[model samples]
Target: MQDSAAGAATMKALRRRRGLSLAGTARALTNVAAELRLPALPAVASVQRSVARWEAARPTRPDDRYQLLLGHLYARTPAGSIAIGPGSDFAELLTALHLLGEGERRTAELRTAVLRAATDQGAGMLSLLSPALQAQLAAALADPARTTDETVAGLAAAVADVNGQVGTLPMVRLQLLLAPAVDAARRLLAAPVPSAPLQESLREAAVAAYTVAARLAFETRDDEASRAAYTAATREAAQLGRPWRQAGVHMSHALTTMYATHDLAAARVLADRAVRAAQRGESILVRARAHALQAEMLARAGQARQVDTALRLAWYDMEANHAGDPAVTSFSAGHLRGFEGVCELHVGDPATAHDRFAHSAAALAAPRELVQRAIVTVDQALARIRMGAPQDAVELLHQSVDAAAATGGRVPALRLRDARQALRPWRQETWVMDLDDHLLDGLGA
Candidate 1:
């Protein structure tokens, strides 16, 4: 087929219709190559990359090995499956293949529209982008079939970059970014790499992708989606067979179950799993966070003594923690303080909760911490209400809901609702009424 957008679109459609990743496509080629003992066949990694390049229909990279191997994989699978379904889709690919026809134009238009919706979301979301991001997005809009040449290291960086933006982007928008990224990482993990180290790196990247995916899925209030992402992440981390990796995965699961789902029993179990794994691993950060999560789980259960013990252990872990394990979860002293505030509130000590929350200023004040800041802001407001000064919480509650508007705003929206529930006792106060009006009014920014 000639290098054209329609050609690329047809190829991608065939693959998607097959419900396979790029690596799954690579597997078909490699399996055929091995069956025939095809000598000098391109490496599995090369085939995966070529599939990517082919699907882009880049002019410079004309197709090679356009023989039985490609036949067994692409051209044949559909015809064989057709004995089993869509003449309409195949018609598009076939007409597009003739290379300058009506089918080509129509197919490409629909493809571009769907791709733009997946990537850009909408003009309102797009308008909020920085000029540089907008330019980058413009290029993507211009070429729906284009993709980056992703190396293992490049994929890792992409995963890291997406994870780093967790709280910054709205949950729905973040899911859009993460969906393609996670697909890429999972595809790479499925492909065969030349070296053990490269394989390990891909596994690491996949776990990290799923970790953030679980958080975003949970934040979007899709409990089943979050569970599926966590299951995949834990499976990948287990395949790595590293305690630190498991620690990271379980810690993420613990946080989700505890905060988002309120599954305290499961949270306790996951938190203990994280602590055990961290104990056997090298990240002091993970160690500290694990204990802190354990403390929160216990606090929520009203076990004050155990909570204090866990909190003390976590403080020591943080004080002594100088370990930086990128292979593990990212944490900060701010996270520990937030955990302490949670513990304090759950243990019926609003004064201490307020005091503890003061140290979480960094979580609430950072520009990049949109979702997290809203969560902590709500917590701070709750502390004020619990301390018999419901009036003091109104301003902070307003700030929390405003942050909700700025972010994709689901997770924090729930928090804002629960905060409202907590304010029912003082609903007659003028400040409470105004706060209610502000929240009811699209959480005015």
Candidate 2:
């Protein structure tokens, strides 16, 4: 008789034959577990290593829980029929009978029940809003009210506030603040307003609102919402005939493609389009920001020489323009340096990245933008890890985590996860374990 290792090999072969990468398989398992209401799902890296061990003919076999999940995900027969060449693991045989008997059917019913419950809860919440609030919302959606000069001025101040809050407020909080404003602005744009000057102001305000809305969505990982907001912003900017506003929107869209979607080719095209649009605009600030965005994207693509050239152009443009519109451009010397550091990190220069992050950290410390501060701290931590200083990396990561907790930002949480993954090799170390435990507790993971 053949060994049980043959069964493990078959499972590995099946996964490969289905054209699923290790990450894809892990995601499938996770989704199935969630649907089945499993108590816990395995990590992606854990699943990857388990697959490798299985293929290597290790003693370990897929556990009962994993067996059920994999079977459902791959549409395989019940566990009882799963053959391992000859003899099965005692644990596998013991659980197989129970799993095949009634567990499978019960799990399917539980998944359906969970879906129905979720749908019902969502409907109930929507129906819970006050009647007056619902009527006002309906009116805003159906027919927009006309805008006045005072309203436009108020909107401009709100845009400025939104701009200032970018690296300070949590993304969810920002989204909550911007959503109603964006809706109101959209309605005002649709309503008939007699004053041409007021109409222009309203359009500008709408563009600003839409741009902020897009940024909020992007930061929160809502790609479709971000894209829709960007589209709306671009349309408003075009109607306002403001090349600078259009350029700003294009730059933001480029960032969304680059960071959010990870489409390098599409990001490059949008970045170039932003530069061209900025060049056509009268505002030097627009040109400066466009160049800065181009530099950041080029750095991510590992185009080192082009990155320096783009950064240089950005600096030149900023120097040529003394004044910048706060609502239009957030470009500054310190912010540019932060981007330069990010570029250096991507270009594989950890030392330079560390130095640049240090500078940015110091510069931002005075104003104390919690989100930006956390980002720079995490970047520094990553650089330190790359430079083979795990201890130093741990310290910086702690700072970043604290900053993130203070700001209630998801970006910091994501960076912390990356740091944790990078430190996996040192998992057995007491300090590393403590740090991991701390992170899990704090992040509510």
Candidate 3:
């Protein structure tokens, strides 16, 4: 059963933030449970059944609060329609804000009902609108008078919904949703707000848009756009006094610089900045990641022992902070392990690198991000190459290159070039000769 109403609200807000479906939320809970190493786990099938029941709108047992929270969190929309008029009480704004703050956990039925009511002025019991009526409704929402704090917050949640859907929708549909929200956010922020809470809300909206824009830029391999977007997010986060968000932007910049351009010096500077911000904020995971990334940059620059020392220091720091889960921040134990593997490969410790790579690959198995997976493979191949198996390295390189192409990322391509170069001495060997020609051809070398 679920906890108190406040607990429900908390779960709902978090679920909405994650943008998961009921089934998806349930699955995530399972993953999080395993990640946290919790015992007394529910079977996947049982969770699925519970989700199905919730989706069907059947009344669930009260003790199932966690399940209900998961259901609500996974809900596609809010549960009720809320409207604020010209003469509406300001308290309504508080109510609307409260709902938005619920994060992401709402039952699907509740969300569906809410969206229907909010978007459709007269849903079911209200008027089933004609095309003209629907247009009128939209026009009414567009009316300048309707842009109250409550309405604006509702719109912000709508934007979050779109952004969340962006991961699953076709690009065109995602753009259709995101563009309007971005425009709306810009307009809202431009308007006068009476309070700090209002400003913070608008700032968060800007940050969210910037984050999405950065992701889109990276997806298209537009480094300039990526950097610009990160800058935008950083500015907003700074304004909101959100140090963790600032750290996130810096880390992202470091990643793009390091992997996209192979600019070790620049990467190191950005990573160092990120580390300092994370430390200042007492963000253990982010600091650990910054340390690990700094180590990676050093290794790439041929500082093996220094890389090892940095990793050791970061690992110890992580232990001291009792960094519970990488999921808590952009940095994770898994990410550190991957970074360690990459450094090991560079420092001529193939065996140790292989083990770390294996740990990274296994740890990141459930939520697959293509660019990250490619990095792991490239690291693994580097380890293999260092172990004197150019053939195996070439095969892993092939996989990495293919995956990177799908992401339009250049990092894996750069790694492939280095891997092939390592095999240059063995090019005359029958096992490596054809592979070399194929690799060069693949890279247009």
Candidate 4:
């Protein structure tokens, strides 16, 4: 729930980045204190209370020892900051707070950028580490206490919180955190099996983490890593024996085959597998997501009739309010409309696709939803070209290049280039030449 940097970074964000809950962080620090035989340690509750106050995420900053211990806890320095910004604005504001010497004021914040920006952009901002702060976070990761019911719950909650960030972050940076998260879950799972329910919870967390990792891999064009991660996720979910979780895994893998490899046959296999798993599961939301994925894949293959049937099934499942569904499903009216739009385009109905894309544009207009909007913008541009308006398509494509670049949407950025090539029939147009120059500039080509 918390966002923003304190003095360059917030302990809370760094703590969460390492897969610790507030209490887990406190306990980790306490454990570290015990191992070092440092003075009488604060009780976990007392430490947790302090951790909450420290999370004010203002420039008041934690003093030296606390900062060093946190660095040790997270296994890194530059532990002082997290993302929340209009770069220049946050930089200036953080500077002003430091200049005044001290104060605690909450600022509205967001981390979508941190997960989307280049890694150096995110962690490199906190470059003020001292020699004394160097320490291993591995100890805490190994602590038997980390697998307690409360801690396991924290792990689940942490991953769920992260998935909430999908569509906002860039594929590269999101994969960074997901790897650590999956590692933390693996640590818990490797511990001698706990109570059956806790074991199941750990498996689900591992499966969820692996699935998302695979998804990001798909986005980043790391086909081998994506494939390996999907395999791990499926193996774990099969052991968990939860149809819904396994279904989620299959649906995500479907995305990889559909986009990363563009292997229609492989995508079809995963989509069908997802639907079968969803059918055996209880969540309509999960089933809806599975079928929607099937519909989207079918759209890509230009299978009009099959796409229509799958879409109808997806919409039917979505009609109900399935409370407490996993955030990973990510289904919405707009998503379905976008799927239909893509289907219409593949089926050679540009005018209908344009309308559907318009609906998609509205749905993805939120400021943080830039990547989705950029993707839809490209589709809309393609539709425009198909409808005999290369100029309009060129204009839209220009804006999309910026959006896609800013959000680390390498895939969409590549698509923007391809969409520009679609204007070859109008190659003599001056605006098309202008668009070419702009694309070159954006690409540093």
Relative to the true structure, candidate 1 has a C-alpha RMSD (angstroms) of 17.4
Estimated TM-score for each candidate:
0.65, 0.64, 0.59, 0.69
**In order, what lDDT does every prediction score?**
0.68, 0.68, 0.59, 0.67
Ranking by TM-score: 4, 1, 2, 3
> Which residues of candidate 2, in runs, are more than 4 Å off?
1-146, 324-329, 366-368
Candidate 3 lDDT by residue in tens digits, 1-445: 3333443354344445557665676687676456435564488778756644433333232233443233322322233323222222212222332333332233322333333333333322111122333333344346533344554455455555544433233333344445555565566566655566766867776777677667656655677977887887777778866565567677778877776776778988888787777776656666677778778888888987788788987897767655454326355677778888888777757989988987886775422245566778888987887787778877777777666554444566677677777878887887666655555555454
Candidate 4 local Cα displacement, residue 54, angstroms:
18
Q: Give every collision pair in model 4.
A: 8-81, 9-80, 9-81, 9-82, 116-170
lDDT per residue as tens, model 2, 162-245: 555555445665566566668777877778765788789889888888988887888787889989999999888988767877
The list of candidate 4 runs beyond 4 A from truth reads 1-140, 167-169, 327-329
**Residue range 339-416, candidate 4, lDDT tens digits:** 778778887499999999889888975554667778888998999999998899988898887776655665677678
Q: lDDT tens digits, residues 168-276, model 1? A: 5556776776676687667656655556776776788788889988988887789899999999999999888578889889987887787776788988899899999
Error of 3 at 261 (Å): 3.9
Q: Candidate 3 lDDT (Cα, whole model)?
A: 0.59
lDDT of residue 215 for candidate 1: 84
